[model samples]
Structures are given as C-alpha cells and as structure tokens.
Target: MQQVFFRLLGPPEIYYNDQPIRIPRRRSRALLYYMVSTHTPQPRERLMNLLCGDMDDESARRAFKTMLAEVRSQLRNIDPSIEWITNDEDRLTFNPLAPIWLDTEIFEKATANRQSNLSLAIKLYRNNFLDGFFLKGSPDFDAWAQSTRDHFQRLYMLALQNMAEVYETNHQLEEAITCIHMLLTADPLSEDAHAHLMRLYWQTGDRTQALRQYERLGKVLAEEFSVQPLATTQELYRQIASNANTLTQPATPLDRTVHPPDPPLQATAETPVVEVRLPYVGRVRELNWLKDQLLGHEHERSMLMLRGEIGIGKTRLLQEMIEGYCTDWRILHATCQEAESKNHYHPLTEALRSELNRQDIGRLELYPVWRAQLERLVPDLFYTGATDNTVDAHHNYTGFEHISDSSATLLADALVALLNQLATPQHPILLLLDDVQWCDKGTLGLLAHLARYVHRREVFILLMYSPGSGEQRLAALRNNATRLGILAEVELEPLSRADIHELVTLFSQLNKPGDRRLHTIDRHISGDWCYQQSEGNPFYALAWLETVWDQPETFVPARIQEQVTIQLGQLSQNARHLLQLAACQQDSFDLAQLGSQLGFTLATTLDACTELITQRLVVADPVTTTSLYTFTHKTARTYITGSMNRIERHMLTQTASRIADPEAIS
Candidate 1:
C-alpha cells in the first residue's frame, strides 16, 4: 500500500510512490482543497452551495456530480490503490481508509507541538495553505480558501516569531535578525518586530542602520495610523541615538542577587514586615459603594454582580473590598475552575469546606438539621471523635447519608440557614465567588435561590464573572434578582489613562523604587498607548510592565502579543477564529464584510460574533451602526495582525486593493 502525499500549503500538488501527480482542472482542484482543508464530512448541500453556488440547483447538482467524478479520476490516476472521495446519500468526505499524508496536517501537527519541534514546524510551513488557488465564479469557495490560507499563514508566522525568540535567546544574532526582518516583511506594522530589527542592527555594530529603522517606523506609523510610534518605541530610539557606542556592546544579564556583607549590622529588634499594598486606583466610587453595602443595616442583604472583561481587575476590586473595607466581615471566597464546571455545586462546596476548616467545629449544636444537610455536600464537616462531648457527638453520621437525595430547594434552604448561623451582628458574612461564569449549574442555582432571600439575612454576596459568560444562567439569575428588587449590578470599566499612570506609579513605589528602568518608564511611557494597548485593563498593563521592567528596550507589540495569545488560548475555538478574522480587518469593521471574508453565512457569523462580544473579545461599536464591530482593545488587533502569515495578509491586501480600484487589479 503506497501512501499518497498531498500538499496544500503551497500549490495543491500530489505524489504517489514518490512520483509527482498532477491534479488537472481548477474545479477538481477546488473540490479536493475544500475536502482536505475542512477535514470533515461536508454536507452535499454545503458543497453545492460553496463550489457551484453560481449555478442553478439542478445545474449545480449536475456540476457537483461531474466535479466529484473528475476528482476521483484524478485520484485514480495519481494512485489506483487510493480511494480519495467518500460519497454517502447526503454527504461527501475524504476517505481516510486510503493511506495518505497531507502537508497541511503535518504542518498543523508540527506547529501545535511547537515546543518540541520548533525548527521542524518552521521548515514545514513552506507556503500558505493552497496558495494562489482561486476558484473563479465560486465566491464562497474563494472566501473559504482565503480564510484557510490566512489560518495557516498565521500559524507559520507564529512559528517564525517563536524561532526568532529562540535564536535571540541562544545568542544567534544574525539568525535572529533574519527572522525579524522576515516578520517585518509579513507584518510591516509590527512595532516589536521593528524595534527588534533596530536592536539587532545596533547589537551587530550598525548604528546607522539601527537609526534608519527608527526613521522607517516613524514613517510607517505616520502614514498608516496617523499616530506617532509608541512611547516605548520612541524611548528606544532616544536610547540608541544617545548611546550608540554603549548599546553596541553585548547586553549583559542584569545581576539580580543581593549578597549580605561579611559582618552584617546587628539587628537590635526583629525587622518589621511591611505589608506592600497596590494602591487601589480608579474604582473609588465603586469601592465606596461596596463598603456602604457591606456596612449597611442588619436587615439589608446585598448581592452585587461585578462584571468585566478577563483582565479588567474584578478580582483586584474584590481583594480591595476584602482587605480595605470588609475587615470586620468573615470572608469566604471560592473561584470556579473551567475544568470543574460540571462538578455539582463545586464553588459552594469549596466555600463551605473552607469555612468549616477555618472554624474548628467539634459539634453541630446550633443547627443540627443544617449540619446533617450540609454533611451531604461536605461529609468531612460532620466528622466526630469518640471522646468528644459536644452536642450531637453520639449521633452517627450515617443518619444524614440520605441527604444527598434531598430536593435542591431543601439543600439550598439548609445552606442558607448554615450561612445565617455563621453570620452575627458583630461580624457579617461576605461571600465572594470569582469566575462565576465557570460556576457549576447547581452552585449557580443555589446562588440564584439565595439572591431572593439574602436581603432578609446579614449576608453580602459579590459575584464576579466576565460578562457574556454563562449568559443564560446569569441572565436568569439577574432577572430573578431584579424582580425581587435586590440585584445591584456594577460594571467594572477599564482604567482611565490617569488611573493607569497612578497604578504604574504605585507599582514602582512598592516594588522597584529608584530603579533606572522604572524612572525611564515613568518619564517616557505614553498613558494613551498604555491605556489603548491594555484597553485600560490592569492585568494586561501589569503583565506588559513586568516584561518591560526586565528589559526596558523590549518592544511593546511583543509584550502585548504574549498577553493576548494567553487570553485567546482561553476562548472557544470558534470564537477565537472569529476574533482573528475581525482583527485582520481594521479595528472596526462592518459585520457583513467580516462574514463575507470568512465565507460564513449571516447566521453562523452572527452566532460567533455574539460569543466574541459576550467574552469581550470584540465589542459592538455603539457610535457606529449596529452592524459595525470593533475589538475590545487596539492591542488585540495588533497581536492578531502581527500573527498573520504573509500569504494570508497578501490576500487581504489584494482583496482590499481590488475593491478600492477594480481597474487596478486587471
């Protein structure tokens, strides 16, 4: 059994037994590309719609049959032993029974296994997926081809970026420079790549060339976005201009160790452990509002939903509430895990277990019925010693074993009673649930139940989750709370520019006072750039700051790319793909244009967009028409664009250029 080698990365080429086989006819080639690229059993109707969309239904069916026959004929000529097409009553698919190796598959595998096979991955990405294979008269197929091309291109570019980082880490300056230059060619607006090229030029004793790169960056930025280079980029330019000779020397790793003197000064008293505090910036009113709620009247139970994007600092606000305001309250915090979303009542169970561990309860004297009910949730809470004389000590835990079979309402009521028992007039109970989007259904239901009755008790519940997460459940919870008139929703907005500056200043004071890098960052950093790049999100800002703190000359795009990639990794595959396409267009794009470019129907595209909007990956442009959408942050667009492959980018540019000047294309 000879294996057929199919290459879709460059030209659509095939080989059997190490001999080249031509796949003749553009339609036949398109059919093969569609099947191999999607790697799914495509419905007959979908194939007809994509490949023969221009034809009438009857004619399209005839044309589709003819194309399939041609495809099979081509495959047979390549290798008679191979069965390439599998057609059922309603679907057509590539036959996996035949021995075959696809370059696209191999490239994807290598890129996915990037850590171990970086070099192989870079080498395997010979060209974009099905390069230059346009299907005339089939707009849908063309759009699909363009999207697939872009996907592989982005993967290849990522491999190159990774390779460049590896080379630079290994001190291969020339190789690293080459990779940076290649990246710039694919993504000219990559500020980090431009900065890297400049740095590499300076490191290799070409001050003149390094300076020229800065001029190039200025021109590009001015011409393209009508904005100046980022403050970090400008700072790098100034540093190189002022100390060209000093920078040309090989960069020495900073000495991070501090050695104690041989005869250290004698300590008269124990050194006080000064608690470092990150100055709570921007949410003064919100924080004060929460404090008021926490300190409200005894009969008032408050349920506050703190909603924001992933890095917008809802957790930090929760922390501030705990440390700065809710000192007198007994805090029980539990964060839901994505992997544990299916676990029944996980967050509540963990919170109860934590509370139980915090307060050593020898017996359940106060609420024996509640104890028996909660024991079903956390059985270890009811453990007793033989010598113990506390109330209910002689009662066997087996008596509550059937509590697991109790109704959800009964369990929720018992849990509420247990919470009430824990709360006192002297110390209120503050229940903090973080990442509530990942909360188990049972836990959410319990929270919803509690929300209705919490106002009657001395409890303050703070539920924090990214907006659009657990939409149906959260919406139902909110609606129920609203109907009861107890729900208080507080949206955590991104930090203002001034707030980010204050945050940076506070971070510097607490962590690295008088550090030269900190001084430089304070002096030259652009508040607008920071705000835009981080979307005023503190987590992303802090991550970027940490990267720059270590290497003051680190390019901004690289820092942003690292953070954005980490975020994108957390999204569903469909949402991530949609975001990538949205990013390829300008920051703001017409919704219809995106759907057309991605070859998605309006409904499918809208569904993906809804997910993206919910996750805050992209937001609807309120000022613009409802059909227009924009990324949550400019940095996200930069990261997405920077990650695109050359061919994918070229296709986009070509499409735009053709649209702009139809005559120019001819």
Candidate 2:
C-alpha cells in the first residue's frame, strides 16, 4: 500500500521514503501540481490554455500533447510499476490510488481539526507556493500560482493570529510576541498586530520599547494607508505613557521553570517524547488523613467517606493511599460503573470475592448459616449442608435481586461477619469501594450496614463518590452514617495554582531529557492558565498537559472535549441540542418556557431534564413553584455552547429571549 501525502503550504515538493521525485519539464510539473492541488480532472482545452496560451490553437494543441506525455513519463520515473496518470480521451487526471505525495495534503489535514492543529499547519508554510518556480508563456498558470500563493499566505497569517491569541490567553507573552512579529513580517501594515505588540511589550516591562512600537505603528499606517493609527491604538499608547510611573506588570513572569529554549520550527531529527505517568499531586494531607483513618493510631477501625466533585481526584487519592502507603494491609478494591449501579450488591460482592480467592476462608470456620448466604455471592464457599438448596460448585456470583427480606438480612449479616473474621490489627482489611454513587441499592444498604460495625472490628471501609452525582440512596446512607457516628466524610477540593505548577513540573521532569519542546511548553503553560483552564482540577490539568505534549502549541485539550462529547453522546440528538440551547443562557432558565420554545410538552421536557440531571450534566434549581434548570459545571456548559455554531447560538438566544421577559425574577 503506497499512501500519498502532499505538502503544498510552501514550495511544491514530492517525496516518498525521504527521496525526492521530480518532474523535469516546468509545464508538466505544473500539470501534476494542478491535479494534486485541485483533485480534479483537467480538460485538454483547459490544460492547453493554462500551459501554452501564447501559441496558436494548433500549436497549443501539439504543445499540450507533448506536455501530457512528459507528465506521464515523469510520473513513471518514481515507480515504473504503478500507473500514475489517467487519460480518458481529453481529460488528464492523476490516478487516485497512485503512490504520490504532496505537501499541501499534509497542511490541509492538520488544520481541518479546528484550532487544535493550527500550530502544525502554520509550521508547514515554509515559503510562498511554488516560490520562484514559473513556466514561460503560461499566463494562466502564473495567474493560478499567484492566487494560490495569496490564499496560502492568508491562511498562514490567520493561523499565526490564532496561535498568538491562544498564547496570549495562556500568558505566554514571549511566544505571543513572536507570533505577532511573524504576522507583522508578513503584513507590515497590520495596525492590529502593532497594537498587540505594544501591549505585549508593556506587559513584559519594556515600557520604552512599548512606546516605540506605537510610533512604529503610526509611521507604517501613514506610509501604507495614508492615515494615522486607529483611535484605540492611540488611546492605548496614551494610557501606557500616562501610567508609566505606577503600572503594575502581570504576576508570575517567565521564570527559569517557565522559559522556552528555542523558537518554533527548530529542526530536530529525534521525535520529542514526553513521558507521562498517572499524575498524583497535592493530596499529601488527604492521603495522610485517609491512612490515619484506615491504619488508626489507636487500632480502631474507621469508615471514611471520600467525596468530591467529578474529577476532583477521589479515585487517584484512593489508589495513591492504597498502593503508596498500605502495602502491608490486605486490600480489596472494586470500582462501580454507571451501567452496574443497579445490579444488586455488585460492588460489595466483587470486593469480597477478590479477597476470598486470595485467602482460605474455609479454615476460619465460618458459621453454616452465614456461609450459606456468602455462597450465593462467592462461588464454592459452602459447608457440607449449608442452605436448603444445594449450591452449584461452578456457580457464578450474580447477586440475587429477588431475595426475601429474611434472606437479605442473612446476606448482609453474613457479609459483615465474614469481614470481621478476615480483619485483624496485624493485617487490617482495607475494603475499598470506588464510585459508590454507582453502587446498587443492595450495595448501598450493605455499606450502610457495614458502616455501623466499622468501629467495632478491624476492617476499614473506604467509599468514594462524587457529591453532585445525584445518587439519593448513597446520600441517605451518608446521612445515616453521620448519625451513627461511624463515617468521617473527607471531601477533596480542586488544586490551587501552586499545586498546578508543581504538577506541571512533575510532568516536565518525567519527559525524556533534552526534549526541545520542554521549555516551549514551560514558558507558555503557566500555572495561572492551568488553574483557570482546568479550574484547578488535576484530571483536567493532566488533559491540558497531554494536549500540549501532542501539539506543543495548543492549550485546549481534545481529551476534555472528547469527554464532553462522550457525555453529550449519551443523550438523544434532540435532547443534546436542547441542552446546548439551554447552555446559551447565563443563568438558570425557566423549564416551562424552555419547553414551550422547543415545542415540547412539560412532561416530555421534564423527562429530558431528568436524564440530563441523572447524567450530572444539568442541575435543577428550585423556584417558588416551578423548577429552573442550569448546567452543573460552567466548563461543561461552556463546552456545549462553544461547540454550537455562532449563528445557531444567536438564533437560539433570540428565540428564547422573545419568549420570556428579562426583568422577571423569582
């Protein structure tokens, strides 16, 4: 399979396996270039006009025929085994599946994925299209080349501006300055770039240079456009001059840790490898508290409820605590997924089965009554004559959802007894249940039951869940545990800016030494941007870092976008669109009015709201009588709104506003 790649963001070039393929004749090369760039068949007349328009019609026809043969001959020079050209009567086309490569193909594909690849797209523009490459007596070809050159330059300039904005937002002043310089180099009369350069210099403490930039902008505008700099630029210059004595620069300047080694497009042979491990940062105190609860100073068992917002590092904290500090303890862990939330006692049964298979519980002399209930959950753990019904030796443990009230009691009691027998101070039992908000009703019940005896036995139960996930049964269990004086709720909070900084440092150090993009990343991605972009969530921080690693110039993580996409994907298309429209609002929206605007019944809207809330994508606020709905997180809402087209969003807002009065407050 010969895959073709094109690179035409600069001078035309074709290569495969690092070997350049050439078309000897200028007009023939232009024919191949035209086909690759436009991906369309060329008619005989069009090709003749494009390549030999100065000659007589009969002579042009003969010249075009000669050029077509030359092109076919040149195409075969690379690989004679392949049919690289297709001629159907009068149309000339490149074989679609031919082993051909083009630089322009690479540029277009890289840039097609939004701003995420703008940096790579910008780098591909090595020079103007077909720089200094022109054929004699081909006016149409020259005209096409000039037009293409302008088109590519405009794309390159736009990409540079986008990169500058992203860098500016991320507080990478130096990188932003470089982008501005690139833009000005391409279009010296750009007043906006000059103005930005002035402001950026002011931020960098180059006050005198900043003032000079304004003067430079004025001269350029007067020379090119016969006008003065815009009033806004003049105003900015005045402000900088007037406040020179008391101007305060931005905080967290480019320190040694946040500095770039070289500019963009520095040639290097080695692929930059950023080694990333599962990052664990700023949970020192929480880890200690958890360890203290599990490995009590007084040898008393503890049940700690680890709660936080989604992606606040609950699961990470649990893993760190267990793997880093509790190697001596017998650990049994089971994570609950949303799909398994209703499978009776699924999480608890998993944890028990895990530990039981590791150790011989038969030697502990478990009671026949308790063992019988245990056998239903764990395969092959029964005595000679346990329950009335004989147990299958190879029975798989799927919790019985239809067990009687008496049977439920025995099962719960049997679970607690088995845990008690297994737990000892010498080898404390650390039973970990992650994402307990997804636990079944039976698992929740058993957890609540287990919580009561936590202080009495040597077992430590750890429960992790998101507080805002709307798990009512889990909430009830939490309340009951609090009343019983057995649960110590440990709520994890988002990381601070300092913590984000530390995390980035940790990530950078783990990268392969001499990774050139290391400093480029350090300089651009300040802790401030990470803190603000991720809202101090480590999960999002890691996502941002990973995005930066792939595209050293990007700050918006596709991972986070993919997550939001997956979250939205769980809803019906109509429901997702409704949610996106709702996201256009800056505050809670009246559900009834929203439903009315979307032509949905109140009941149907209510069901949609319930689904969104259940997914934790939206939250319902209480009004006097009616409930208003809002997205749970501003980030998720922003993502949804940002994904919507500007015109669509505007129309949605206009339609919504027309249906309701703005001054109406609850």
Candidate 3:
C-alpha cells in the first residue's frame, strides 16, 4: 500500500492501502508537516530550527529529537518494518524516497495530461485536491494548495469542452453528449458547457432533452445573473426545437466554406509599398553579359558604364539586372530625375538620405555628420546656411553656394567618408547611378572619388548616361580616371520586332487574338515606333504606351488620331518646319544642306535638330561627333509627308532643289 503524501495546505493526514491513517497528536503531526512540505532533506540542525524557530539553540535541538521519536512510533503501527525516514549523520543529510502520492503533484500531472491526451487529463482532475481540506495561515502552503486545485478545475472543464468539440466534429454524438455531461458536473452554470450540451443533444436525436437543457440554462442565467441567453444560444435552441425528428446530418461539413484564397501578397499586406519586377525583355544577351560582369568578377571596385541616347533603355537594363541577374549582390540605387530642378547635388542628397534612413539612422547631428557629407556633394553648401525657406538649420543646412573648383575636392573627401561609414559590414555594395548625365558636377565629382576606392573596397559602381548629353563630362572624367585605371562603357541597341512583340505579349494583359488590330499596331509599330518616336528609348516607349493603350471601343480611330494630334501639337515650330523640309527631301538628310534649303541659319538648324532629338522624334548616329541625323521612325516621316498641304509641299521641294544647286533658284 502506498503511503499518501500528506500536505497541510491543510492539517496532516495519511493513507495506507488507499485508506486514511488517523493520528491524533497535533505536535507529532507538526514534525511530519515540516518534513513533507519541504522536499529538501532537512539536517538535524535545520529540523531542530523547524521544531522551534525562536527557542534557545540547545533547547530547540532537544525538542526536535523528541518529536522525531513520536513520529517513528506512529509510523510503526502502519508496519513494524516500515521505516519512514532515513538519515546520513556524517553528511547531515535526510531523504524520504518512499512511494507516496501527493495531491498537488496529481493535479499538475493531470493538467499536463489534459493538454497531451484529453481523456487522461479529465480523469486525473476528477475531484478537487482532497476536497474539504484546509490549512489556516501558512500563506505559502495555502496559496500553493488553492492555486493547484483552481488550475486543475479550469483545465478539467476545458478538457471536457474540447473532447465534446472533437466528438461532435467526428459525429460521435453519444460520446460528445457524455463529455458535456461530465462538464456540467464540474460547472453546471458554464454557458458554453450548456450550449455544447444542447448541440450534442440535437446531434444524438434527443431534441426534446436538448430544448429542455436550453430552457433550464436560460432560467439559471436569468434568475442567478439577470441575463438572457445570447443570440447564438437562442438560435441553437430554436434549431433543436424546430428539428424534432431530424438528427443533424452526420456528413455535413463542420466548418464554413473554405476561406476565399487570400489575395496573392508579398511581405505584409498592411504595408502600402509595392515592388515592380522588371521582365527580361530584349536584353537577354546584354543581361547575360551583365551577369558575367557582375558574377564572374570577384574583385571589388569593378565599374560598368551603360551609354546610350535619351530614350535608349539604359535604365531598364540596370533595372533588369537588379531584378533577375544580381540577386547575389547588395544593390544601392539613386536615380537622377529631370523633374528635380534643384541644385545638381540634389540627387546625391536624396541617395545618401535614402540609404542612411534605410539603415535606420537614429538622431544624428547634421552639422558635422550629414553636413560633412553635404559639403562633399555641394561644397558651397557649407558656406551658406539658413539662407532660404528651404534651408532650415534644424531640418537641413542648404544655403551653400554652387560647388566651384575650390570646394570640389573637399566635397569628394566628405562624400568618401560618408560612404565608408554607410557601407554595411561584409556586404559587397553595388551603387547604381542612373542618368549620371543629369547629376550635378559636385555629385559627379563625388562619384569620381568613389570610383577611386572601388577597386580597394568591396564596391561596384554602375553609371548609365546619355552620350549626347553627358559624353563631354563623361569623357573628361573617364580620361582622368583612365590614368588611375577605372574607365569602361557599354551601349544598348533597339529591340528587334520579335522581342518587342514578345514583351508586349508577356507584360500586357490584353488578349492578342481579340485585339488583333492593336496587336498589329504594336507588332508593326513597337519595333521602330520607339526608335522613331522615342529614338528607340525604353522609357519613352513605356510612357507612350501608358497614353495610347486601351483606347475606347466607341472611338478607336479617334483615340489614335487624338494621340497623333497631341504629339504633333507639342512639336516646336522650328522642328515642324525642318521635319516638313526633310519629309519633302529624303528620310536621311545632311543637317548643313537642310539648313541652306530651309533658308535658316545653321544655328536655327542645329536648334531644330536638338528639339527633334529631345522630343525623340528622330535618331542620330550615336557614334558620330557630327549632327548627321535621320528619321527615327517611318511613321513620323510618313505623318509629315502625308499630312502636308500641296502648296507648302511644293515650296519645300523647290527650297531643297535651290539649296542643292545655288544657280537653279537664282
């Protein structure tokens, strides 16, 4: 028979062969109380103190020895062979290793079992810890005692409810009903317990009993708590009442319709940011080349220059590389926008601030920290502070002068210092500077300084620019950098028709067969259209598509006409006149001869070519130093020649004839 582990969260009691062992002497029980309550093996010295916490040391030790003798006599009645305690006097150790069961341990194990296996968890919590037991004022023992029972009761009730849910889900109506009954025994007023009982009653074809339980529960709540049954509780009661003969269909789905598939999302849906994945279009080969350049090169400080005309897709190439090719590298990007009319170093400021903020800068002083960087990008910025409304000392320091020659080097050093500080540890930095042509001289100088350390540090600098606009500055910088061994360039070409068609097919949602006319337009026009309208520039093509796509069904031709008219209206008078003269002549024309034919000054002709190129109406030989230009697209040439009036057209031909042979018109 196991001796019951007695605790005095209340007064002490014992069990032998599953029966209580009554011991009447209160002081003898106190000795047993101290030993059982504390698991630590108490020494003779500690036991003496427990027996008398405040008596003289000698008297306390004597009293504890006498109490131990009494406890041994009581234990002898259970069995003369039963030895209740063991002691190692040499080590001052006492240990109780007998087989005994404690209510607190039972309660805890039951709680754990309930979580792992509900049935066992429920059985273990069949009754409160030694029901009707009590111990006055040993607060530590009392709190531990009551807390264990309370936790067990809560867990047992929950276990019964969960078992009911599992049984109901499995259509085990009788078992589920039995589980709820067990729950009601423990907590007769648990609303959920009753509600689940009602559900089980209906499931088991006992609708009358289910309705009766509901009424009983409702009355209990109203009389005891002054509250009516919840709507769900009432609805469920009504369900059971109406369905007298029908047992709940066992095969019915227990859950509601599968939640609609969550909308496809990247990262958290609450964030407003969206990322665009650039498609691999016509630049597969260049992309491969770029991949090789980025991947095969292990050395840091490698630089790649993508040089092209304004609309020629330099930016797109870099965007593609970032999305598809350069996953292994850490890309930090800054784009120079034509919209920003502030100082040249403004782009650099935006870039620096974005990277710093992305790195989560916390409360940094601007004067020496950010100001030092600002000085490098705009040296004159250091000289001018708090000059304009845009320059608030606390928010920013922007009153600097234009970065002249004297401050350029100082600015470079500051920028280099800032970059060195910003670089993340152990990561290769790929600095992408798009539209480098638009970058101010100060920013350009900073980039030049960055290039100097590119080889030494773990950094790759990629710069994309238009040769027409940036060639001179780029050449000067490259020539200077060449002496230091860091100059390279790559050029982009127009996408072939097949590639353009494939891109439209892949990116645009419009059905190809349904919108054959538009498809035909795209097929015929996308190839040379960008070349002609945007000098084969990807940005212009994308922007132009945004304007012309999805024309109204009621006015398809009208939409096309409107678009053409809008673009024609935007043409400068000089470009319109020169385009008309070129239309009367041939597709390709010498600029000097065209100027003589139009009876316009060479400067006027040059300005007209500039307008056409700026508007992307024509393409010039990007490799040539001269102003030799041609119609960028067949449509532009055809539009001008086909739309010209007869009289103005004849005058253009005669002007061309006279400009070719001076004696003819004279």
TM-score for every candidate vs. truth?
0.52, 0.50, 0.44
Sorted by lDDT, highest first, which candidate order results?
A: 2, 1, 3
Q: What would the per-residue lDDT of candidate 3 be over residues 1-666, giving only the tens digit for each residue? A: 556555432334577776777656544565565455434344565445434555687876676677777777767776666566766662122245655665435434444442356776666553764356543322333333343344445546666766777877788888888988887787777666777777777766777888899989988888998998766677777667777554342211122112122222121111111132335568777777777666665434356787765445565566667667555555666666544424656666555443343122222222122333353343322221111112221222343344333234435544554555545435556777676656666566767777885434456678776543334556666766667676556678877666655554554554345665456555554544534443444544454444444444222222223334444565678778887887666556676677666678878978877766665556775556676677665545655666778998888888877766779888
Q: How many backbone clashes does candidate 2 have?
A: 10
lDDT of 2 at 634: 63
Model 3 vs. true fold: TM: 0.44
* Alpha-carbon runs more than 4 Å astray in model 3: 1-278, 298-302, 327-330, 337-344, 358-397, 402-407, 424-426, 454-457, 504-580, 601-629, 636-666
Cand. 1 Cα-lDDT: 0.66
RMSD of 3: 25.5
Local distance difference test, per candidate? 0.66, 0.67, 0.56
Candidate 2 colliding pairs: 5-102, 6-102, 6-103, 6-104, 6-105, 7-102, 7-103, 7-104, 8-103, 8-104
User: Which ranking of candidates, highest TM-score first?
Assistant: 1, 2, 3
lDDT by residue for model 1 (116-140), tens = 6867766766676677678788876
